[model samples]
Target: MKDAAKASGSKEQTADTTGDEGEAPAAKPKKRKDNKGKDAPHYSVKEPAGYYPILPVQVVPAAERPRVFAYASSTRRDFEVFNRYDLSQDLDFLILEIRQGSHSPFLLVLMYNQDAPDDTQQRGRSFERFKALALPDMPIVIAMDANEHHPLWEREKL
Candidate 1:
C-alpha cells in the first residue's frame, strides 16, 4: 500500500479523512499532554503530516494520493487491485503504510471484531500482532468496528 500510494503517477486520493460521514464540523487539532516540547507532530484530521488519525475517517477528497488498506469479513471483488497480505488470513485485519512528502512513514490498521465479551481474547491477540509490527518511532493508527461493550473506550455514567 505504501508503494502504491507513494507512486508518483497517482494524483489524488478519493478517500479522505472523512469516510462514511459527510462534512459535519471543523476538526480540532488533537494534542497530547505527554508531548511537551517533543518534535512529534500532532496529526490533524485535515492534513496529517507525520501521524495517521485512526478514527473519524471522513469521506472528503484527500489532499494527496493516500495509502489505503482494508480488511473485510468476507472477500469482495472490489479491492482486488490493491496488494493483499495473508499473514492472518483467518483474521479480518489489514494494514497500510502512508508517507507524506519528506515525513516519516506511519501505519494504519483497520480491523473488525465480534461483539461478544468472549471475543476479547481474540482482540487482544490481534493487538499483540499489531504491536509487534509497529516501529518504536513510527506513529500508528488503528481503526476498529467492534460492537462489543467495553470500559476501555467507554465508561458508565456515575
Candidate 2:
C-alpha cells in the first residue's frame, strides 16, 4: 500500500485510506495517522472493484534470452546464469548464491530437463553436467522439475 500511495503521486485522502464506516474525519484532508502514527497513504481506484497493482517480478538477467528466471518481490536477490558449471549446456539452469547475515552463502540451483526415454543419451547430459561441477562445501538447494523416475534415486517402481 505504501508503494501504491507513492506511485499515485498524491497524499492518501480520507476516502482512499479509511475503510471503517465509523472512523472520525481528520481536521485536514489527506492527513491521517496510520497505525504506527505515520501519515497514511493509498492509491486511487480506477474502477468500482478497487485498485490492484501489478506485482513486481525480478528477473536475474533482465533479458529475453534467459528462458528460466527467478521471480521475487525484492530485486536485491543474489543470482546469476551460472552456466560455467554446466559443461554440456543442455539444461535450463539458474543458480542463486544467497548469504544471510553471518551465515555461509549457499547455492540455489533451478534445473528443468526434459524427460527422455530410458537408457537414452539425451537425458544423461544434464545429469553429467551437474555431476561434473566442483562445488564448494556449502548447503546446496537444487530444484529440478523433470519426469525422470529412475531407480538411482531410490525409485524402484514408477
Candidate 3:
C-alpha cells in the first residue's frame, strides 16, 4: 500500500494511534505530516521483539531446508507446514497446508519482500524464478516495496 501511495505521490496511510482520543467518536482521524509538510507513512519500531510490535522485516530465509519458525499462543494447533521456498533461496515465500484432522485443509502463506518492483537485476533475480512457485492449484499474494530514494528504506544502497 505504501509503495502504491508513493508511486502516485499521495498521502500515506498508517495504523498508528496518536493517543489523542478526545475527538468526537465520528470525527475523521488525524494525519501526521512530515517535515516537508507531506503526510508521512506510519513509522514502526517493532521487529523480533514483542515488547511493542513486530516490525517490517528483513527475512533471512534459511540457507538450507527444514528450517521453520512458528508461534503458537493457544492449545489448538491450526497451522501445519507444507513447504518453504526462497527464490534462488532468497526468501521468496512459505506455504502452509493447514490440516486439522476434523476440518478441511487450506493453504496459507506469510510473505513479504523488500525488493523493488522493477529492480530484478539488483539481486540477480527475475520473474522467471517466481514463476516456478506459481502453483496451478493455489493463488499467490505478493507485496513489495519499490523505493527510488528514501532514507528509512532498507533496499541496498547500490
**TM-scores of the candidates in the order shown:** 0.32, 0.37, 0.30
TM-score for candidate 1, please give it. 0.32
Q: TM-score ranking from best to worst? A: 2, 1, 3
Pick out the ten consecutive residues of candidate 3 with the lowest summed lDDT: 57-66
Candidate 1 vs candidate 3: the lDDT winner is 1
Candidate 1, residue 17: how far the Cα is off, in Å:
30
lDDT of 3 by residue, 40-102 (tens): 333423224322221122222112111222332233355333322221223333344455667
lDDT of 2 by residue, 1-158 (tens): 22223344533222223423343422344565656896443322222232322211111111112224343333333432122222222325555555666677677776665543364454554445566767678788888775476566775553
Off by over 4 Å in 3: 1-70, 84-89, 116-131, 134-158
Q: lDDT of candidate 2 vs native? A: 0.42
Q: For candidate 1, lDDT tens digit of each residue in 1-158?
A: 22343354533222232322343322225533323553222232342443333221222222222223343222333232222232222234555555555666665667664421353344454455555553446676778765466566665543
Report RMSD for candidate 2.
17.8
Q: What lDDT, from 0 to 1, does candidate 3 have?
A: 0.34
Q: Clash pairs of candidate 3?
A: 46-55
Largest TM-score belongs to which candidate?
Answer: 2
Q: With candidate 3 superimposed using the best TM-score fit, by how many Å does residue 9's alpha carbon deviate from the native? A: 50
Lowest lDDT 10-mer window, candidate 1? 56-65
Candidate number with greatest lDDT: 2
Compute the lDDT of residue 145 as modeled in candidate 2. Answer: 70
Provide the overall lDDT of each model, using Cα atoms, as 2-decimal numbers: 0.39, 0.42, 0.34
Q: What's the lDDT for candidate 1?
A: 0.39
